[model samples]
Target: MLPSLLLLFLSIPLTTVTAASAAPRCTTSTPIKTYQKCMNLPTQGASLAWTYHPHNATLDLAFSGTFISPSGWVAWGLNPDSPAMTGTRALVAFSDPSSGGLLLLPFILDPGVKLQRSPLVSRPLDLPLLSSSAMLRSDSSVRDGAGLHIFATLRLSPNRTRINHVWNHGLYVQGYSPTIHPTSPSDLASRATIDVLSKATEMGPAVPSWFRTAHGVLNAASWGFLLPVGVTVARYLRQCTSVRPTWFYGHAAVQIVGFLLGTVGFSMGIIMGRASPGVTYTLHRGLGVAAFVTGGLQAAALLFRPKTTNRYRKYWKSYHHFVGYGCVVLGVVNVFQGFEVMGLGGSYWKLGYCLALSTLIGVCVALEANAWVVFCRRAEEEKVRREGRVEEHQVVKASIGI
Candidate 1:
């Protein structure tokens, strides 16, 4: 995992590449009705142009993609519903290493995820590939390697006057890694919208992109880092005699703030899930729930804190330690899972969290060492004082006897 992240960060700074048509290559002699848009990406970028012929019920799509490596896969697809991979009808193209010819196939993202595994098996699809309907051209616009130009003419339903508002996304697999398939998790990372001859203007994703960003940042900082910081204060700083009750108050304050932020972040995620019908992150959701529940338990425990003289004080301490640490671990793990779910596993968000967590661990280690040293010194002083008292008692007994 670490190596993959290093590789991703090393390769993510993308370069701009253009695939200019030498001349106007509209499908028809007359001015073609066309729509064009571009989406910038981390590894590469894509520009899509489509022409609609209402009379013939045909849609001509040209997808030009920049490539970081020459050998691998690139796909452009229309998802009938949301912009997720599981429901997309994709036109997949890859350079066959053995045959040295570009092979194009029509694939459907199925209900099951097995199709996303390596050695991608041919699957049944709703859209049939028209005879000689696919075309591939070399684009020398990219400096690192040649780009891929994929063009296809697809048939639309009869009597359909306007296109439905649908999601369009693209994917690229770098090099020929056997484990990586077209429908793999990483392939779902890049996407863009396509509006072609739709009467209702698309409003955009169910949850705005900015909202998702906020959700990730808030939860990761609160649950992942700040909560742990509060735990550290209660564990280590509370022992400092000089600080007295300040550490207790500080711990309570930080924990309260972290819980509030985490609650807001968790709510955003729930809203986002409702906004997109077919898209779901099951593991991320589960982990998030577990963290939230345990965190709530810890907070509620504060209300029933046992007094130091209470017979159940040991039980309360045990419960607090177990739940608090468990919650912290889950929160941190879920944050990483959220990053992957958002296609940001290698992004700076993950990097920043890692750096913060690392700093916290360093602080804990330093403080623990100082605490142990102070404890040892106090123990030594107490032992010496006891020895002195015993000597003085012995001397007084000897003088009285004389």
Candidate 2:
């Protein structure tokens, strides 16, 4: 019995050794998060996988993706708090446009990700880069035709396992071209993001779907669709002499209603900004305010409208026309800016808007040409009548011999 017990004890340690040796060193199959988009992003797909080893206080992270660009820049980053790119620690890799060789560096995404300025490559939060612990491998061969496949490993801050960690990761890429310099900010914006949660399907507080839907519908309808419609009515419909008061009333009614709707949409945008703590669309917000103020001035002008016979009427007409057109231009521009802010840039929303505006412009061009033709005919007829009257008066004077 004692010999059998000794044999069992010896076999246990041997079995443990074999199991440890066979354990997979890299975490690949089970990723904590994934982001996939059918859109033609440079990094077509990305994933995050991690394993924590308590013995050495090491956190192994695998940030891997497929880069379609043969050159330019590709990056993945972790944001400790919010998903905004400003506060992130990123690992960037690219084929140096100047050298034609791969270059990898760590960058801190601060002061926002911009396309005009260069990125600052350094450790964020003073985290040390464990150069010895890092490994970057890529498949750049034509036989692999799947494009550039990059797999990178990074060491996190020491004792990261003990701290409760909440993370979100983002992927960004810019394609290489002759005009695009490596040091220059990318002309093309390509990016995606996903939350890394400890528990699957768990997420932070999100803005309600209904609120977002209302905001989009209201703004698109008011600023993009209705404001242009109002402008068209004022410019073209009012030209019909038969309509007279009808055209004026229609113009006023449509302008008033559109302005009111736009005001509501603008208010909702303000509320949304407040709800979102760290997000701000400065250009969109500024343009929206300008549109609203111009629109309001137009509305007030109606209240103080002067009679046509009044001398100041000419001045009012000039002011009203200027402000009205200005409002329309500003409103349309801000709507496009809003699309980009919401990540709907280059989307079908923008395409639909362009199509609608183009149609309106075509109609205006046809109507304007017809108006000029009518005015020229009327002026020529009046000139002929005046000449005939002058000839008749001369004939009568000569016949009377006086």
Candidate 3:
């Protein structure tokens, strides 16, 4: 298993993209679409779109409009069903007349989550997701900071970005302008769209594109590293031994590492989605969360089991059996889904997992058959002993009566 993990690291090729130029004055992120394609010409709904290059191409952004305010703009995007839009300078709505569709402005929202914190743990962000680039909420707005610089904290949506560990090295594009626009409502003057893509240009070798690729590599590596083979090893141990100690330790360790990588990787997925909202990315986020939640349940069960109690001590077999099986099933299913999302739909990874599981199943069946044979032989021997004892007792009772 350790060898397989080590090989996994060496296997996935790493790719990075650095910026080629400097941040131009009044620049927006490239492949900047007009309001037309953002609407999806014919059957237009909420749009979410993006591209996944192998860390070679320049950063792609859709919304290109720049605000000219003296103070920095406080930009935020939320579902109206969430925080309803008010007329405050901190909030603005961009509603298109033709579509009657409202979207938030700018490139800020991340995937894997959306704007809500109710008891309902998860909900589809419902934005139209597309590959390459996506449209923003047409009804959203940005309020100027004293009408000069734009600054705001974007509450992340798991569906928007892969809420990965990339936060430590976040790619933010902050712009400070000289004048404030009189036409704007806030205290400041001029406005501009500071795309993170341009920030990549300014960084020389330190580009935002590299972060994007890093996010993908982590996602692939996490999903690939375990879950498939680990699940098989853990479950196979169950049919062989009632204690399932090997199964327990193996499953726990794999899950711990798998989830850590997944958490960081999933965060990147969310970031990708937020950078570009689309169905493929959103589905990826949803599955990632599902895996995380199930893993948590499995971990919690292991934690709460009363290993010290008398009954538990005796029934450790039962606890181990159930938990082991559950982990195997969930882990296997999630691994399959992860591979599909990671663009390895028909790749060697799929073949390897298939053969490994099939082989494990065969081994488990053989072991179970052997156990049953042993059980049957023991039952027959016990029956003979009981019959002989009954005859002896009958003879002794007759002698006593006489």
Least lDDT summed over 10 consecutive residues: which range in candidate 1? 14-23
Top of the candidates by lDDT? 1
Provide TM-scores for the models. Answer: 0.59, 0.56, 0.42
lDDT against the true structure, per candidate, is 0.66, 0.58, 0.40
Measured by TM-score, how close is model 1 to the native structure?
Answer: 0.59
Where does candidate 1 stray beyond 4 Å?
1-104, 108-168, 171-205, 396-402
Cα deviation of 145, candidate 3, in Å: 43
lDDT of 1: 0.66
For model 3, residues 87-196, the per-residue Cα lDDT tens digits are 11222223323453432333322231123222112123333322221233231332221111111223333233321110000111123211111221111101111223
The prediction achieving the highest TM-score against the true structure is: 1
Evaluate model 2: give its lDDT: 0.58
Candidate 3 residue runs with Cα over 4 Å from true position: 1-15, 19-284, 312-324, 395-402
Candidate 1: tens digits of C-alpha lDDT, residues 306-338? 999999999999999999999999999999998
Task: Flag the better candidate by TM-score, 1 or 3.
Answer: 1
Write candidate 2's Cα lDDT for 136-174 as tens digits: 343542121222323333454555432222112222334
Positional deviation of residue 271's Cα in model 2 after best superposition, in angstroms: 0.7
